[model samples]
Structures are given as C-alpha cells and as structure tokens.
Target: MSLAFSERARAEIDRLLARYPTRGAATLPVLRVAEREFGGIDDDVMVLVADTLDLSPAQVRGVFSFYTHLRRPGWGKYVLQVCATLSCALRGCEGLADHLEARLGIRAGQTTPDRRFTLLKVECLARCGESPVLQVNDDMYVNVTPAKADAILESLP
Candidate 1:
C-alpha cells in the first residue's frame, strides 16, 4: 500500500517548509511531520518524505537513524530513553536501565510485548547535573532512580 499525508498534515508541513529557504533545509521538521502522519518512519514513509522534500530516501533515513528520539515501526505507547552518557552512568544510570529492563521485561532496543513501553539507552538528556535521567517521549525526568522510575511509570496513563 502507498502512504500519503492527510490534508491537514500536508498544510502543516507546507507551512513549516515555508519557514526554510529550501526544501532540503526543512528536512527534519518534514520528517517529524511524516513520522507523526505515517505512524513512524519505515521504508515506505521514508520514500514519501523524500519525495515531499525533494530529498533522497537515503538522506531522510540518515536523519531518522541519527536521532534516537525519533520513533520507528513497532514502537510502544511510551518510549523510555535512559541516558547512558558518562555523567548519567556515574549516577547509577546503569542500575536504572536494569531496573527498567526487568520491570518491562525487555532488553534495551526492544519493546515490551504489550507495546506499552520501549526501553532505550541513549547519550544525554542535556541534564548532566541531574546525572541519571530518563526521557519519556518529549518530557524529561531528571535524577531518576529505580524507585522514581516506578513512580514515573505509574504516572503514565
């Protein structure tokens, strides 16, 4: 089957593209829009994004693969990105990741069977002072301990 953005999504992407001087310059936002529209960037969606932005599919895939924050196919309702940078590692981020893995029953880079949560070990949340940090979707959780992580999971709807 083919992929296409809704009219509203197209209009939104067009508006965003207008802000940039060239379509190539608007790649990231366009990918974001495509990700949201096509329900995460798979091969077909990448082609759609490339055609929309006048970019190569490889170019679109490059940007998508570079950003761990971007969702992919089979991602769950909540994406748990645990920082694995030096600062976070120093603050017991490894234990935090272990806790999440055991609790979610999935290893890093894997999604839960129920698709409620997907665990990941990433670079940084840009909150070094907080040390151990976890990013749930667009929201950041600083100073996250195993206990705090449980509470955070409970807080999710």
Candidate 2:
C-alpha cells in the first residue's frame, strides 16, 4: 500500500520546506500535514511520505515515531485528552477521567463503540493554572468538573 498527498497537502509541504534549511527539517511539518489530511500515520503513509520527499523509509518512520501527536492508526473525530500530570491530578483529574470513562462507556485509549469519541490520558496539556483540564480536539477546557464534562460531551454531535 502507498500513501498519497492531496494537491493542497503537497503545496503546504512545499511552503514548509522553503522555511527550513534541510529537507529533513521539514519532516515534522510534513507529518503534520499528513496527520491532518489522512487522520493518522500508518506504515503505508510513512512509506508514501518517504517517496514524496525522497527520504529513506527509516527517516520517515523516525519522525513519525518521535512525535506523540501522530498516531499509527486512525482516531475518532473527537479526541478527549485528559491531563494526568501532577498538577492536574492534584486538582482531581483522576475523578474527572473516571467520570468521562463511565459516562462515555469507553476506557482510556479506547474509542466509543459508535466511533464518535476517543478517550486518552495525556501527561499534561500545559494548563497547570487550569489544573483539571481536558483537551477536546484542539480546544482546551480548563478546570472541568464532572458535570461540566458531561455537559460538554452531551453537546457534541
């Protein structure tokens, strides 16, 4: 199997490559495009990127493995990343996480049966001030209580 980049994605990669001195430096940016475009980076996608950039598969794989943002498999539309670091934990992240899991009927690292949501436990979202925070997709919700989280999840389509 091979991965193909859309014209728009290729253009974006070209624009990013121009800012970097070396093609290897463009790896992360290219991976970002691939992630947004294809949803995630599987082995085939990595190989395709290698072919597109004239880099070795190892090089492409290296970048993919190094980045936590890039998933090896596809993910649901909604990614609920709960902060599980010291600060968030102290603020009751564990209870928040449990509430989400029970309400969503899905455990951490698992997607809902309907494939509408994926619950994940992340180290930190850099919102220490917010303490108990959870990132839904690209948006961060700070100091989320169980009730607020339920309301937020219910609001999703």
Q: In model 1, how large is the Cα lDDT of residue 118? A: 89
RMSD of each: 1.4, 2.3
Candidate 1, residue 34: lDDT: 80
Q: lDDT of each prediction vs. the true structure?
A: 0.90, 0.85
> What would the per-residue lDDT of candidate 2 be over residues 1-157, giving only the tens digit for each residue?
6457988998899999899998887888888888888878888888888887789999999877754456545577788989999999999999999998999898999998777888999876788998799889878899899999988888978
Candidate with maximal TM-score: 1
Residue pairs with backbone overlap in model 1: none
After superposition, candidate 2 runs with Cα above 4 Å error = 50-68, 71-73
With candidate 2 superimposed using the best TM-score fit, by how many Å does residue 150's alpha carbon deviate from the native? 0.9
Best-fitting candidate, measured by lDDT? 1
Report the C-alpha displacement of residue 109, candidate 1, in angstroms. 1.0
TM-score of 2: 0.84
TM-score of 1: 0.93
